[model samples]
Target chain A: MRAAYRPGPDAGVTVSDDGMSVYVARLPGGPLLVLDGAAALIWAEATTAPATGWVARVAELVGQPEDAITADVRAFVADLSARELLVPLGGDADPPTRA
Target chain B: MATQEATGAPSAGATVPLEVRIGFAHASVQWIADRCGADLLHVKGAALDPTLVPGRGYSDADVLARPAHVRRLLDELPRHGWELINTFVYGSSFEHSATLRHQDFGLLDLHRIYPGTGPTPERAFDTLWSQRTTKVLGGIDCPVPSHDAQAVVLLLHAARGGSDAKAANDVEWLWTSADDAARDRVLDWVGRLDAGLAFSVITGTLDEHRDDPAYDLWRVAARGGTRMEEWRARVRAARGLRAKLTVASRSVLVNVEHLTIVRGRPVSRAEIVAEFFGRPARGLREQVSRLARRSRR
Candidate 1:
């Protein structure tokens, strides 16, 4: 199922000052993950507000057509979801703001 | 494909900004504290009210737990990723906090007491907790002392900071440049916390409290003293004879926990024995040099 994503309830995330990297950790204990380049952009767009057409936004940001990036983006998001770092949005909820 | 690196335990240096790492550290500790049903107030460092000291930089997370809950929090911390790198006694002369490190989140100082506050730690925690507010760190709504109470805490920390420029800057922003009302608010908290003896360092009246047992402790802290002098002050400030003896005894013993941190590995028993004997001679040398410098001056 194609679903919008938000940072998982158990994840703690911080983005680099340049917006080029995203650091994510599972709560309490961790396998801290650093995502950069297209991955960082995907994580940022996927978890942003409106929770719709997020993958398309990532395609635009990276200067690629939606079709060209769709499969890869889905695969990346799926990877994160499996790790519980990012979760599919269940409803019309806004993404969280990082501190 | 966007590159992703899974850092099980990254090198000593981290690519993540320290503030960001510290924010996550606060969140992690807050998570552990909640599951254990313990209360903790994030303080100073990343927890400071941003308005009190503009652009203050902190290298670590600092949290003050209720005195009664400290032991439980200590026990539960290991269940999380926190490794106790330094025990409270070795953390500083005050013995107010223990230092722990996280593989991913860097360092956290779990303070049982915020030095300079409290006729008692229990009462001090209550005084700050009663007027608490919240700040979002790493997307977690962590409890912190009220803005005014933070101002007091910062000032107290600055009192013990000696000549550190950062401490001086904190004093400038929170106290020296503040208006009469802001000053009054800080003084009120100091009174409530029974922190007058220490806060006197900030007011330039430390001499007036010469009779107070803790006065020398504040004296050496606010005005850089030798290791020998610092240990003497700690012994004097200890409440009972047993505590005083404990503090005195600790002066000559090797702090193996501290040695581990300094060497970046656990010390051999022989290393510990060598340090145990070497420390007294080092203290004596430092004392002699200090006296010689004084005499020459």
Candidate 2:
């Protein structure tokens, strides 16, 4: 089964000066960046209105295919986790219950 | 008119041996700079947005040692100070610690470039070096990276320290401060790293600045995975908790706290310490226990 991307509690963020700071944080140790500004568009779409499968919906936001959003979401979450920014959701192991 | 200066002064020259950086940990840098006398003529790091002032802001302390004195300065000063901390891979030579109580009081980073570079890649440093300007620092000739390089370098450094460091929040100012051309030039520089795992990490960072009308660099960072628009909400949330942050100890139970006033409300320092470890304040209990122990002693 394909891993369905689930959005966590981490807030959507946007850098004003753009994505020059792609993966790395603002200065020393911070969050990851796509540098393509994908985080910006998704941040807007997902912020005010909460949704399920928010990651896969990114493509729709950027005028790309839904598959593209899913792919990018996987990559973004993977990168964020590697940098210690996002905590793992522990898929399949734990059943999802509405918080 | 003739005048006489006060005789009591801080010691000159480095107080400890120089240590090399394994990756980006700065604690080693601070430990050594303390013992070594840091004249602190000029400290550079992060960006110099037209609105941003040099020599101000919540800055990470950096110190410069004369090239001629570099070898000798790093060689001596081990006995005077005890070990404060060391990184995962501390270069045998570079040892960081805090020694002085003025200016760079809390954590001092010893470096050839004090608080130098924005959080930029090595290539960014090369770009900075390419356009370096020679300046006399502490009575010696020194070449400093251009403001553009400085800005990028500061951002990269902030990225390395994670969300815990104060200077990292300077990204909030970058969009609100720098011009489009300057911001675009930086995005172009970072665009070079778009096709790797590193690019994916740029998402959260890019989202932080998605709304700037000034430049589209966030678009560049979005290519990795996350788009700038996706981060708008997080940016708003981050702005709420940005300033008041701290990583108090290096122990396994790392203490994180927010220390600044956000939106006119101050972040309670004690609450922050507790929040850092997911528990309520135990400081008062600990304080009482310590007092009891002292009474018995």
Candidate 3:
């Protein structure tokens, strides 16, 4: 299934003063995902916006061509989804929308 | 100073982080303890080096006092704005009986024992007290356990808490900060606690990486036997049938204090029950699948 991505419902994120974003899973002893640079930007955007145009947005931010960045963004998002740091939007496991 | 004057009026201004407030509370508690002539030794979160856990936060100040002087602390601490909240009877190492709460300072867990339970030597508290030295932590001159003693307690705590990341980090800091002599001393104490095998296993793994090993030998050693050893110890520790029943009931019941501590609010009885049993089913499925995969290997 082609799944859209969003931040995991249980993810608690904290961005440090040094621009490192720490995404801790709400589950006890869950993985701590530390993102920096492009990865951090992708995570910030993914949490707030849909993942449909993530590649182009990230490419623009990182000064890379969309074609060059697409594969890396997909890989990163896939890894995060596998780790439960990113969840499939509009699925059975989809989180309730925030107000 | 009156209690209100000491704690000051509850301010609605910019709030300080809990960790920073805890630092000030440590100093305030020390000042009160010294005034009461009760020798105090800081332990656990409050005693950990800030350099090691940069953003580490604490919900309470853990202080160890001589068993003889506990009464004095109970009397004097209240005068300084620490109100007795509730007593806990869990078999925790480093905690005595009760907890105290202050408006500004948060919680204070008063202890009469060094390492609360497990396989610690009978005179562990006395030994730790004798070796206690003054260290300036967050500008508070407080007595802290000797490096060797602190290492033992930290390792045991980590093991008991199921080798959580924070605990592992604390142990790593202890290892890297200690000199060869201090390390040897810690190993000696681990030996006395009959935890040398566990200690070696944990340290060996930690040296290789920061990952908490799936199987922790330290936990086994802390129980003084295998996985079943802790239950047997608890049974033995219980004074009477009623005491044993109390322990058993506590294990089954949802501890509201635990919920409150974790959530930072007073959770209702129903919420506590829900929290206790609301283990994500996905986690269980994942664990089973992991075990199945391992077994297939």
Give the winner by TM-score: 1 or 2: 1
Candidate maximizing TM-score: 1
Residue-level error in angstroms, candidate 2, position B180: 2.9
- Candidate 1 residue A40 Cα shift, in angstroms, is 2.5
DockQ-based ranking: 1, 3, 2
lDDT tens per residue, model 3, B1-297? 000111233442112345444544566667667777877778767676555445665677787776777888888777766776665454242224578776655667787664333244335556677778876543457888876676677765655444467766766666666678867887777765555434554465423322322122233333333223333345445658996676656554555665676687788878966866663343355557767887999
- Cα lDDT for residue B179, candidate 1: 98
List, in the given order, the native-contact fraction of each candidate. Answer: 0.71, 0.00, 0.00
lDDT of 2 by residue, A1-99 (tens): 223233333312223344321122211211223233565454333322234455445566667766545544555556545544344434421113322
Taking chain A by itself, what TM-score does each prediction score?
0.84, 0.46, 0.71
> At residue B145, what lDDT does model 2 achieve?
49
Write model 1 residue lDDT over A2-99, tens digit each, in one string: 34677888888878878988888788777667787888998888787656667668879999987787778877877888889888875422332223
Q: What is the lDDT of residue A15 in candidate 3?
A: 52
True contacts kept of 2: 0.00
lDDT of 1 by residue, B1-297 (tens): 643445543552356677878898999999889889889999999898788898999999999999999999999998887999999999998999999998778899999999988878999999999999999887677999999999989999999999999999999998899999999998999999999988889889999999999988899999988789999999999999999999999898899999998998989999999999898888889999999999999
**Tens digit of per-residue lDDT, candidate 2, span B1-297:** 011111113231121111111111132222333346422222343213333434435334344443344444344423323222322112111122222212112233344431212233243234445665543321123344455545554554344333433444555554336688867865654554222122222335444544542113223222311222222222332223431121111221322221231223455666665555542234445556667887999
What DockQ would you assign to candidate 1? 0.52
Instruction: Tell me which of candidates 1 and 2 scores higher on lDDT.
Output: 1
